[model samples]
Target: MKFKALWITETAEGKFERSIIERSIDDLPAGEVLIRVKYSSLNYKDALSATGNKGITKKFPHTPGIDAAGVVELSRSEHFGTGDEVIVTGYDLGMNTSGGYGQFIRVPASWVVKKPEAFTLKECMTIGTAGFTAATALHKMELLGQNPEQGPIVVTGSTGGVGSLAVAILSTAGYEVIAVSGKQNAWEYLQHLGASRMENREWVNDQSGKALLKPQWSGAIDTVGGNTLVTLLKGCKLEGAVACTGLVGSPKLEGTVYPFILNGVSLIGVGSAEMPMSTKLKIWDKLSGQWNCREKMNAIAKEVSLEELKNTYIDTILKGNVMGRIVVNVEA
Candidate 1:
């Protein structure tokens, strides 16, 4: 069957081109389930893939969207059947696989989760992979005994997708949240998402060359890696856990072990894409129930069509200009 999709290709000059075009359902990779996608979400990784970032996607002529929510049209696994509403995020969906940029996606049944009772397909995409990563960080931190009562939690990159959701989720879970952002103009938006206050990036990006600094927060959800990750560890309180979620700043970690040995600080790595299905379900359940931040979701979401993704957002995101999650209406 013919379907609409955003397609990316690399030219002989090594430049990548993006366009919306028609695709065939038969062109999809072999999988146990076929979903008619109603919605997908834009992520930084998707922007990288769309721009021919070889690290994110190895092939050209690809569809780039890592998070998808829709209804199952076919299924081979006993876990799902036709007409089942489902969500698929992470696990190679947008990398080497034809992904959610298309109106349809066929993926392994194992990669699919039945849509939570509280979320419509659009709402699911609103939370998307960004929120999933944030939730995973919270899950791991709490597993290590970190709690809101420990003290205020800091969310770095507070205006971006994961950071924005992290602030909301942490606050919804009863933590006092301090949002860190370089954008001085986002204070009101941050406050609306439950952040108690805001800090400039310099507040967390210490450059004093000290091995450690005074503890500013009880714990943290850091999306900006490299020196920012180091700063978080150096300044974290005893038993404080830092969930390292992204490397947008840089992939390098140049720091000492003093935080782990002398301060009892723990660094939790959140790799949501490859997390076990049981854990994925657990996080999704929390997001839909106890951790549901419906108001925050509404405030943080901006819907766009496939053409807009190609004409605008894909480039805008790479430039770090987007404020919140951009949910895509694939059928629009």
Candidate 2:
């Protein structure tokens, strides 16, 4: 059967032109399972790949979407079967393989997880990679001995998908959350997502190159790296930890080791793309049940059809003007 997909073809000038193309299972990359994708979600990495970032995607005429959820149409492994609902994220789905920006996807069964009972296909995509990353960061921080009694936890890029979900989960777990963002218009929205207070992006930026700043936050989930991460490293309380993810700002970190040595601060790097399947399933279960925040998820997600995604990808995400998550209904 043939299905529709948003294909990115390279022009002679090396730019990409997106168009809906008819594709069949034969066109999909070889895999152990074939999934009829119901929904997919956007991420920064997807934006980069769609724009022909060689570091992310080496080949053109590729589909770009990092996360997807749907029912299995065919399977070659005992772990999954036809008609089973499942989700696929990370592990090369959108990088070097045909990804979720289509009505269907073929992926190795090892990369698939049974969809949690708490969420439908749409809801699962609403959470997608962003929510999973947030949950994983929180879990890592807790494992590293972070607790609510310590003090307020700060979340940078609070308006973005990962940061927004981090605020909701932390607050729902009885922790005080301070949401930091550069978007002045999103302060109220962040508060609605359970942030106890809203802070400007400046709070996480130390322009003086201070080796150590006064301890402010008990812990932090930093989605904006670069100067923001440097500031977070310096301001973390004694024995505190910060989960560093995303290089939206800059990949370089120019900071001293005084925070780690003097304050015993630990920086945990979060990579949701290449985690083990067991860990991914565990986090997905938590997000579907105990850590679930329906209100906040709805607040941060804007549902759009696949047709609308062209402009969304080119304008909102590529230009850094997007806020929250954009869930794509592939069959819409």
Candidate 3:
């Protein structure tokens, strides 16, 4: 079958070009399930791949979308059958593998999750990888005994995809949220997402030479790494956990081990890209049930056509100007 897809090609002169192109089912890489993707979502990693980031996509021509929600069109695995609604996120998708920017995606059965009845395909794309990451961070934190009663949870980079979802999900799970953002106009948006309060980026960008600072929040979900991560660890309450999910600020983590030793604070790395299927199912269950924040997520999400994604939203997200999730209508 012929289908439309976003195509990225690198020029010999060393620049990347993007276009909408036609593809065939025969062109897809080998996999156990073939899905007719109805919706996908834009993410930082997708932006990187589309712009010729070798670390993301080593090949010249590729499709870049880390999240896809659709119906099975073909299946080689007994675990999934044709017509099953499903989701594909992380793993090697949108990186070394062809991803959801296409109208169809063929992926390993193990990388596919049957869509929860509670979420529609579009709704599944709305949550996408960003929501999954945020929810997983909270899941891990809870597993480590972090709780709402311990104190409010702080979320950094609060206007971005992951941060926005983190704020909404944590609040839905009964925690008071302190959102931190560099954007001056984000307070109202953050408040709408259920943040009890908002703080400037400086609040969590401490530069003090001290090993630890006064305990601020009970725990944190940090999307900005480097000094911001250090600040989160330094200011967390005793036995509190800090879930690290991004490196938007910087990848380097330069801080003393004092927080871990003295306060028993824990730093949890949330690597959703390669997250286990079992854990993915557990997190997705909570997102669609007890942690259902569809109203807030819907409010934060805006749909875009594949054309619009390549022409506009990708660059917008790279510039750090996007306020929330941008769900891609692959069928559009």
Report every candidate's CA lDDT: 0.93, 0.88, 0.93
Error of 3 at 151 (Å): 0.3
Task: Give the worst 10-residue stretch by lDDT in candidate 1.
Answer: 315-324
Residue 166, candidate 1: alpha-carbon lDDT: 96
Task: Give the per-residue lDDT digits (tens) of candidate 2, residues 134-213.
Answer: 89999889889999999999999888878888999999888999999888898778888899899998888889867898
User: If the candidates were sorted by their lDDT against the true structure, best first, what order would they fall in?
Assistant: 3, 1, 2
* Candidate 2 stretches greater than 4 Å from native: none
Q: Candidate 1, clashing residue pairs?
A: none
Candidate 1 per-residue C-alpha lDDT over 24-79 given as tens digits, one digit per residue, 9 for 90 to 100: 99999999999999999999999999999999899888999999999999999999
**Total clashing pairs for each candidate:** 0, 0, 0
lDDT at residue 61 of model 1 (Cα atoms):
86
* Stronger candidate by TM-score (2 vs 3): 3
TM-score of 1: 0.99
Question: Candidate 3 residues 2-24, lDDT tens each?
Answer: 99999999888999999999999
Looking at model 2, residue 175 earns an lDDT score of: 90
Superposed on all Cα atoms, the candidates' RMSDs to the truth, in angstroms, are 0.8, 1.1, 0.8
